[model samples]
Target: MIKVAVILTGVLLLAAYLVLLERKLLGRFQARIGPNRAGIFGLLQPVSDGIKLLTKEDVIPQGAHRRIFLFAPAVVAATALLTFAVVPMGPDLHLGGRKIPMVVTDMNVGLLYVFAMASLSVYGVVLGGWASDSKYAMLGSIRGAAQMISYELALGLSIVPVVMLAGSLSLVDIVDAQAGRPFILVQPLAFVIFFLSAMAESKRIPFDLPEAEAELGSGYHTEYSGMRFGMFFLGEYVQMQVLGALTAVFFLGGWRGPFLPAPLWLLVKIVLVVTAMIWIRATLPRFRYDQLMGLGWKFLIPAALINIVITGFVMVGI
Candidate 1:
């Protein structure tokens, strides 16, 4: 129970810091100053934001489905926290005369664990949207479900080559295979598919159609207020960080570095991956809904399937 509490606390802390990093990165990229007033370079922005959300008045729509509405944000946040359980930050290090690995729970079936938890996370958005009894919320939920399901097919298939090559579904084993040579080199197409699908799954910039502001008026969580609204927002950013960590574990070689200690190495790799995500967000414009759907089905899926076929033949020939 203590370990669970500790892991949960750590995840919350990491998620808070990630929001600051994203803001700072976006500010720099856009040539506009970010939140420097709250704390050091707006380091206190998250802190202040949390306080504000906590103190704000809670507003539940009278016509809304009350039970599910109360449950949605909590479900999303819990799912985000659950994923970190299997995320190994580094090798065991001796601290205060005890060796401790920086992961929560590295189950034997790490790959399936992540996929299962990831599938569960989408339900929060769908449920929240439907419970709101608003057109925008319904549309947003529908879009979220369709988008997640569509991309997950390609996303799941694209990573199969990595599994086949490594001959293990364990994330730790996958990292081992890419230790000396990153998977990005051998499976370039898979990397692209994994990356794009990851972006869609996380619902950032180009793939964030469900929450499109101009069209949907804040989309699914528009009816939510107070800490409830905060949960959804924070959960999205945390999901971004979690997905970035997964990318590091699967492709960038998790905690595989020299000179720096293992934990530091893990942090460095995650920062790089998260920075790239922010860069992509700043550079690309959001895709139209229909265009987004078309690209996923027509381009990404086909390319990922080809990547798998190519990898199979190459492996058999060898």
Candidate 2:
């Protein structure tokens, strides 16, 4: 238990650095310098940000539900880290004469665990908006709920093909089976669908309708401040990292590469995916809520279904 706790702490710390990396990368994407003013090349920006948020004054809205407001951010942050417990960071490694799996849990129903965690995470959004006692928060929360639910269905259908091909739900097994060939080649369409949907599920770019600044004023988190807001901020970036890692694991072939150790391969794949996400954010304009919904249900979901059908047919013939 202590070991699990320690590893989790390390993962959270890594997530913090990831947010800083995203900002710096975004700066490079936009042809501008980023946070090098903070510390040596801004390596310490996340640490500075963490300290600022923690020491800032806590603010509750005039009529906000104080207890619910306080609890919502914590819930989101906790759930985001929990999903990583099942992700295989590397092949099994020997530690002190006992082998420890890189992942925290090796469930037969690993994919299902991800879906379940996603579903439960909605409470954080719903609570955050309701507890804020503000119209903007409510609207943002509603947008978040609708967006997540719509994208998740497509995300699930898309990945079903990979699971079908591998004949297993264990993440580690899926990676091992993709030793030479990545799932991206077998299901490129599904790969596109999953990547886009995961972005929506994480409330990132084109799909970040909930946080659309022009319309929502910081969205569902408008009323949160201090560590309450910090938790949500951390949760968002961690969610991004988790989603990027999932893209690598299920499609890009987790921890599989030539001339690189398993952990390095996994990290390299995840960083590329994360950079692509940054590129998308830098290049694409935010989608209207209606347009976002239409793309997910009218396009992505059906496309994923078709991909699954084709995959099923191919596997049967083989």
Candidate 3:
């Protein structure tokens, strides 16, 4: 219980700062100043943002379903935080004559659990949009659901090769399986597929058709106000960190490196993945809705299937 609390607090704090980091990086990418006024180099920017969100007036539309509208944000924030429970931050540490695993929980079906929680997050978006009683919100939510469902297949299939190699669904086992070398070298295709699918799943750029502000007027959370809206924002950034962690665990070799500590290595890998994601956001244009669906269903899904079949045969041959 203590471990769970600590991890939850840590993840929330990290999520808050990640928002600031993204803003700063995006500003630099766009050749403009970021949030440098909040504190030295915008160190206190996230704190300021939090206060503003919390202090803002909470408004509910006249026709909105008040109960579900209020509940929806909780679903997003909760599921995003829950997915981190099985993620291993480092190897086991010996303390007081007992070994303590770095993860909050070590489940045999950790990977499945992560994906399950990810799928549940769509409900929050859908419900928030529907309950708002707004056409734009409804359309955005529908797009979010379809996009998530489409990319989710590719996301699951992309990791099959890793599961095959690791011989276990446990994330810790997956990390351990990479003791000698990371999976990226052997399963580069899976890495690319997983990364792209994950970006879509997180509802970020190039795949952010659901939240295309120019078209949908802020999308699913169009009617959300104050910290209620902030919850969705928080969930997105936290999910981004979760994706970074998963990419590190599955491909970059979670918490495994020489000279440096295991946790630090894992952190380094996550930062690299997150930075790449940010760069993509800065460089690429958003895909049209049809283009987004086509890429996921036509290209990524089939590619992942082929990768899995090839991996299976190679394993059988070996």
Candidate 4:
């Protein structure tokens, strides 16, 4: 219980600051200053943002389904946080003659648990859009559901090679399997597929068709206000953090590096991955809807399948 509480609080706080960090980095990428007035270098910007959201009027559209509208945001935020419960942050620690694993839970099917939570998040987006009774929101929700479902295939397939190599579904076991060297070196193609699918799953950058501002007026959350809208916003950043951690664990060898504490090494790898994401966001233009679907179905899916076949053959022969 105590461990869960600590991790929950820490993740929430990290989600808030991640927004500030992205804004700062995006500003740098665009050659402009980001938020700096809220606190030194905008260090306290998230605090101010939180206060503003909390104080804002909570409004609901008259035609909206009040119950579902209110429930949607909570679903997104809760699922995003819950997905981290099984993520192993570092190797077990020996304390008081006992070993303590650095995770909220150590389920054998941790990877499946993560994917299941991810699948559920789409319902939040769909409900929020449908409950609003707004055409734009409905369209956004449809796009979101379709896009996520399409990319999820690629995402899951991309990880098959890693699971094959590690011979376990538990994230801790997967990390341990990489102790000699990270999976990125052995499964570069799978890593690329996973990274790209992860970006799409998080609804970032080129894959952000669901929330395209020019097309959908902020997409599924168009009718949300105050902290309700804040929950959706918070969910996105938290999901990004989750992806970064997963990438670190699966490809970068979570918490495994020389000359540094395991947790710190994990943190460093996460930051590097997040930075790359930010850079990609700055460089790429959003994909057209058809283009997005085509890439997922035609390119990423086939590539992942072929990679898996080759990996299986090689492993079998070896």
For all candidates in order, the CA lDDT equals 0.86, 0.88, 0.94, 0.93
Residue-pair clashes per candidate: 0, 0, 0, 0
lDDT of 3 by residue, 170-242 (tens): 9999999999999999999999999999999999998898889999999999999999999999999888889
Measured against the true structure, the TM-scores of the candidates, in listed sequence, are: 0.95, 0.96, 0.98, 0.98
- How good is model 2 by TM-score? 0.96
Segments in model 2 whose C-alpha atoms lie over 4 Å from true places: 94-97
Candidate 2 global CA lDDT score: 0.88
Residue-level lDDT of model 4, residues 17-43, one tens digit each, is 888888999999999899999978789
Where's the lowest-lDDT run of ten residues in candidate 2? 2-11
Relative to the true structure, candidate 1 reaches a TM of: 0.95
Order of the predicted models by lDDT, top scorer first: 3, 4, 2, 1
Better by lDDT, candidate 2 or 1: 2
